[model samples]
Target chain A: MKKVFVLVLISIFFLSVLSSLMGGVVNIPLKVVLEVFTGKVTGIERTIVIDVRVPRIILATLVGIALSLTGAILQSLFLNPLAEPYITGVSSGAAFGATLAFFFYLPAFPYLPLFSFLGSFLTLIMVYLMAKRNGKVNSYVLLLAGVALSAFFGALVSVLMVKSGRDLHALVFWLLGSFSGRGWSEVKLAIPLIPLLFIPMRYFRELNLFLQGEERAFELGVETEKVKKLLFFLSSLLTAIAVSVSGIIGFVGLIVPHISRLLFGPDHRRVLLASLLLGPSLMLSSDLLARVVFSPSEMPVGVVTSFFGAPFFIYLLIRRKN
Target chain B: MIKVHDVWFSYEEASVFEGLSIEIEKGEFLGVVGPNGSGKSTLLKLVSGSLKPQRGSVLLEGHEVSFLSRKEVAQRIAVVPQEYHLEFDFTVEEVVEMGRYVRGGKGEHILEELNLMPLARRSFLTLSGGEKQRVVLAQALAQEPSILLLDEPASHLDISYQLELFDLLSRLNRDGLTLICVLHDLNLALSYCKRLILLSEGSIFAAGRAEEVLTPENLGHVYGVSAELHSHFGKPFLTFFSPFEKVNEGLQIHIICGGGSGSLLIHELYHRGCRVSLGAVNTLDSDEVIGRKLSLPMAVEAPFSPISDETHKRNLELIDRAKIVILAPLPVGPGNFKNLLALEKAVYLGKEVWVVNPDFKGRDFTGRVGEIISRIKEKARFFSSEEEVLKELENWAS
Candidate 1:
């Protein structure tokens, strides 16, 4: 049953990737897209399929993998079902950092991701420090601090938007989260973070033990404090990289793992593997909807994701109560 | 083997243990018992290497536990916590497999050993309290540790499940596992653990065999209650009584009871602060159990034997000292016909003689026992129940 589910998820992911490449503005035919891949087509069709859609798809896939893996790790680390990547203020901090970069007229290539990484990492450190009582981190305090710091950084980003003159439009689009106009450079930025995903995969057993509780995990031979610190760092880094490249895509990080767990079970080994596939499939489908639903004028992919994610999340909450 | 040597530990300003030391032998079934806040759980944590003592060492197999890596410690010891709350819906087999984290294996044998194979696929969150605890125990056992530590694992279980759990633990201990369990139920502790460590206010008050460590005086001093230790089926059993405020203090009440009829009346009178005594209760009788537990001055005779003249004389002496003598609704048999004779003597002494439920319709085993009851009817006050007798006593005292 698990293998069938995995196979189905992989197929849906491939279908979503192919459809995303073919269903964008100026809707290229599948034959043309395939021919472009085979080097038999050229000019605008080739550029549209290769230069524009391919990197966007790859960036979307990487961001999807990063966010979903982050959500899965955070949920287990905090022992909270509702934990997600941005639950630690990483997305808002990255947005504030990107807004600062744009406000200062810094180039978008490397400086944006670097500043975003710094912002998210600093926010994580601050939350960790605030939540530490004695030498141990209290997950409840960490959650509260993350939420409070997220709102604070969000307010700072809004303030930066209000003061900016020429960057207002760019800030708004980035804040709403879109993968439009991104190419290989952003994919290049996210490729380094793929290793971060594998680090958490190695700790699947530790993550499984964490669902019982921290004390139980420790008694069961996990170096709980060290594992928590390492996983927290990796998840924050993944969130920062994903947010920096694609802006704040909502619910992919929050819902992908949940969907995977609902399809599979709660064992992190299968959940992480399922999330790796489902995250990209959901992102690609949501991005495809964002493009074709509005035609030449695209809706922000974040908006499209939220459109589906909010109701699905509400359904999950209601079902869990029973 | 584990040795906690002079462990000085505290949580913030509240010190839990001070200069506490205990050594447990291999293959020993030891129970850690105490009142709340006596550091039973803390001792388990220290030995498990989850908590380090400030000024002492917890040595496992002659190695300092705090210095060992978590995997090394877990390889030797497995701890079953009080409660396990899972946020995710992991199945029982997955949970038990987590026990093999330090030492990797399938742990299928552990599942079969714990009888969890039937529920292996069930979600842990959907299990009952007893089932969840059993799964946790299976998880701990999957580590294949030589020593097992439990923190009141059966506190949340039903009475039957509690016994089932301890029976399983005892079986495991008999299989050469060193079991150190912290138990809130003293009876459960006494029944299973051959040795006991009694803690009071974070210190070891007593430690030895169950009989030596769980004495009535030790239990009374630690729990602030009057306790009695009795042996049943060669196991120590404890009964406790809260020290009641003196209501009828200095009032002597003699109860002429046999069979199990006088147990409740004796308990009520004793708890009400009356100086209660018993008369001519046969050994091993149900009433005799209560009388012996309370340590009340009483006259006793061999079971099913006729009340001897010496025991009847002793019963008369007890009745003579009492300000009030009450006849319990005990059946009159030929073996205990002397009890009716003692009640007549109480009437003659001018003491307040009360007969509780004098209707002995089917209870008269001796044909002539009812005739003696008629002789004392003029002087004896009749009440329907023990409650009525106690109310009348309260009224008479005022």
Candidate 2:
């Protein structure tokens, strides 16, 4: 049964990759796409496939894998089903930092994500410290602190948006989230950080140990405090990088891990692997839909994901209740 | 082997354990019992390395528990906590296999040993409470620790399952696994645990073999109740009674009993503050022993001796000093046939006479005693048990 699920995910992943490469405003045909890849095409089609489509698809896949893996880790780290990168305020914190760069007129595209990384890593620490009691993190307190901090950082983002007299359009577009005009330069920075996801993957058994709660996990020989700090650091790093590249895409992180766990069991090894594969597929499909839905103009991929992912998440909650 | 040396553990501002010390030998099944807030569960946590003491150490095989590496501590001690929530949909097998994190294996041997083979593939969320507890126990045992600690393992289970779980613990102890359990039920602790420790107000109130540790005086003083400890087939048992609220003054009851039929009545009457006197009991009778234990005055005779005129005169004098007289069910043999005559004399003296389990009809060896009891039966109040007698006493006192 697990093999069949893996086979189907692989097929869907390849299909979405193929479709996302060809399905865009320029509408390159499959034949043209194949030729461009095979080095048989040139001119505008070659430029479109190589320069525009390749980086965009690569960025979408990278962000997908990053966000979904972070989402899975967050859920296990907090031992909460509703835990995600956005819900924990890492996305809002990163976005706030990027807005700081834009409002100050710092070099926008090249050095922005460094500030974003600092913003999110610091926010994770703040939330973690606020939630700790008697040497253990209370998950409910952590959730509430995440919300209050998210709102505080969101208000800062708004303040920056109002201060940016001429850059408001860019700030709002980034806040709403998009993948437009991103190139190989941004993908190059992200590729180096992608391997850090393996750190969390190696602790899959420890993550499973946490499902029985902190004390039980400790009794079972897990260094719970160290594991928690390591996961928090790794997941925050992944989320900051993804947010810097994709401008805070929503719901992909929240929904894809859940769908993976629902398809596979709650064993973290299978769930984490499935989420890594499913993340790219969902992100590519959402990006494809965002590009083609409006024809001449594209909707923000974040908007598209929220539009579909919210109701699906609600449906899952209702089904889980019954 | 485990030794807790001068352990001092506190939570927030409240101290739970203050310089408490205990030592447990290898292969000894020990039970820790206490009232709520006495830190029974905390002691287990300290021993299992889930909690560290503030001022002392828990040593397992001469190594401090909190100082050892987590895997090292886990390899020596495993705990079955009070309860756990099942939030994920892992199978029973998956849950049990998690105990093999340090030393990985299939965990099939533990699953079969715990009789969880049939439920191995079932979702953990789909199990009943007993089954869930057993699954959790299986998970802990999968660690294969030398010492097992359980905190209130039978608290939420029904009686049958409670017995079954304790029975399983006994079997595990017999197999040479050192067991330490916190139990709320004193009877189960007394029957199953080889050694018992009773804790009160965060310190050990009593500790030793169950019989010595669960003495009536210790239980009554700690729990604010009147209690007795008895043994059945060499296993200790405990019985509890209501403590006296206030002494009902100016009331007295004299009981004529033998053959162990009046011990319970004597205890109930004494606890209710009735001045009780037992009469015409032969020496070495079980009832005489109970009467002496409660310090009630009794009219006694030699063993196997019939009630003499002097003993009868003393019994009548005791009945004369009482407002109510009780006749406990006794065989009317020729040896003590005068005891019934004493009851008739008490009724003839216009005292209120009560007959408990009145069966003087065929209990007669003298043959004429039935007619005498029937003549006095109209004036006597018949009661079934001590509970009914206590109720009547309450009514009369009020």
Candidate 3:
């Protein structure tokens, strides 16, 4: 209950902050923007606030939530303190997919989502197959294999981009990650897996048993491979959805769960729950700041997140050591 | 109940056990002791269902163990391995709680009985080896298993904990838990075990009550040591005596025994292995136990025993195989005078004769050693060291 309150409280806070910043008298005057927000104002003001900023903020929040949950699950899966959602070849594979899409001279490059989705899925399978020796899967082997394949796929992605001749700027932007193209369409695409992802998130105690080792868990009557497969399928689907909409957002999925763990402990129950709630709140607020900072010269939401998240991640690491 | 029938196990090229069969009844505290690579640990693994036997099967409580799912097996039997390298820093409470993993629930009583309640919240990895061992035992007990398989569980424990652990196990057994333990300590086995099984070269060499099975002869043959089996308050124990040594002024054994094979038999007669002076050969000869191992001063001839010390003293020491006489046809002759006198001394002492080998075709003696052999022949019945040797020589036939 207290956790929910904290999440709700942060959500309302970011919502108000975003609304006030986008139109409040500093930009379009408080009364006008307030009126627009309340359906009292007429014409362009209503269109701008409701259609533009609201959808983007919601998208940012949902993406953030996805990234954080994925990060938390990945960490415990490998029993590695350094593992993150992106570490499993998701981002790089998605980028490779997007780069391939850009090369085809296809009418709608937005179809890049399909390419990145496939790339991510392929990388995930490669990692699983490489790590599963006989019937056993070792964490170090999985991590190393994921890292190597992700790098190799990333190089292939870069080569594809270089061969294509249609203004590299657009392809580069998509590869780096940004929330500009996301609206209700992308938002709708990402939310369906929220329920699927929540299934594993609810079973953190089982995940804890798994961390003890499969042999022990199996002795305890846990169907360990099933649990791992479920986690893989759910986390990958959610990651693919997030990457599909937003080019290849790094650091959010990598760092959010770490912060979640620092606050909520290693128990996936609390960490995943907190992640689901806090992610959107943090990502939404960052998008709001990205929009209003140095007005008229829009900054990519990805740049804003890195500037904020990277320093905070380092601080958490050092502070955790202390 | 544990039944291993015709089970075969090996590590790579070396076969530890093949077609071996044994049955252990419920609540039986069975002690399994063996030489290295003799299938002691392998037997435990097979019974625990931790390893699959290449041939035949293991039945527990009249059910096939290998076919049971891991959970079902874990619920039935608890296995405590020798090494405990727990990576997670779980508290004692948490560690013990894992034992109930098979129950898919919890058992608070098992942890408390192991005296782990006080250390419940203490980190498991931080504890000393003894403490960790207790915690591990607590975890296994937490399973509340009907049968327990412990493999060298006391290897890391100090003497105090070793005894304490065994006491706890005995108490558990008294409460009707069946235990099968593989132990290297013979005395500990004799003291605590209701039955003892001695394994040699991956086969059951001896098994019965400690008093019945752990005889001096059995120890000498199975463990290759001429040991003295001791008993205290009706509980049998084993302590070795070194071979006869002139240094002690006891029966000086001019062992006609050859080969490094007999070293352990001679060693058990001494301290550690045994305490006995050696004789009847050059210092370099392998059969001279103390002469080769302990640098004991022996009446050894240069190179081979000369007619005086070599053949003669050898014949004299042959008298030591028996205070009576042991006619080992080491071809006695004129040069082996002292050996002949030694045999005469055995006859005079009225000691019995033990013929170690009956296969050698030597109606012979040349040196003093050979002379001693011929003299002892009438008194000792020549027999090989097989089951038949004791049967043929139980009463001094000569």
Number of the top DockQ candidate: 1
Scored against the true structure, residue A175 in model 2 reaches a CA lDDT of 78
Which regions of candidate 3 fall more than 4 Å away from where they truly are? A1-49, A52-54, A94-118, A128-144, A163-167, A251-254, A281-322, B1-24, B30-70, B84-89, B102-106, B182-229, B232-398
Q: Highest TM-score: give the candidate number.
A: 2
Task: Tell me the RMSD of model 1 versus the true structure.
Answer: 3.3
Ranking, lDDT, top scorer first: 1, 2, 3
Q: DockQ of every model listed?
A: 0.77, 0.76, 0.26
Better of 1 and 3 by lDDT: 1
Per-residue alpha-carbon lDDT of candidate 3 for residues B1-398, written as tens digits (9 for 90 to 100): 78889988887778888789999998899988876677888888788776688898899888898777767888888877666545545678777777776775556787668777788878787899999988878878777789888878888889999999999889989999999889988788888888888898889999998767777778777766556565568766788654432232343333444334335435533332223344344445565634565554344655554446445545555454534333333444444444446546766666665556654455334423444457666866566663343344333222
Docking class of 2: medium
Per-candidate Cα lDDT values, in order, are: 0.87, 0.85, 0.66
In model 2, which residue pairs have backbone atoms overlapping below 3 Å?
none
Deviation from native of the Cα of residue A216 in model 1, angstroms: 1.0
Tens-digit per-residue lDDT, A72-94, candidate 2: 88777677676677767888888
DockQ-superior candidate, 1 or 3? 1
Report the C-alpha lDDT of model 2 over B210-270, residue by residue, as the tens digit: 8888888988878888888877787668898978864555578899999987888878778
- Candidate 2, residue B76: the lDDT equals 76
Judged by DockQ relative to the true structure, which candidate is superior, 2 or 3? 2
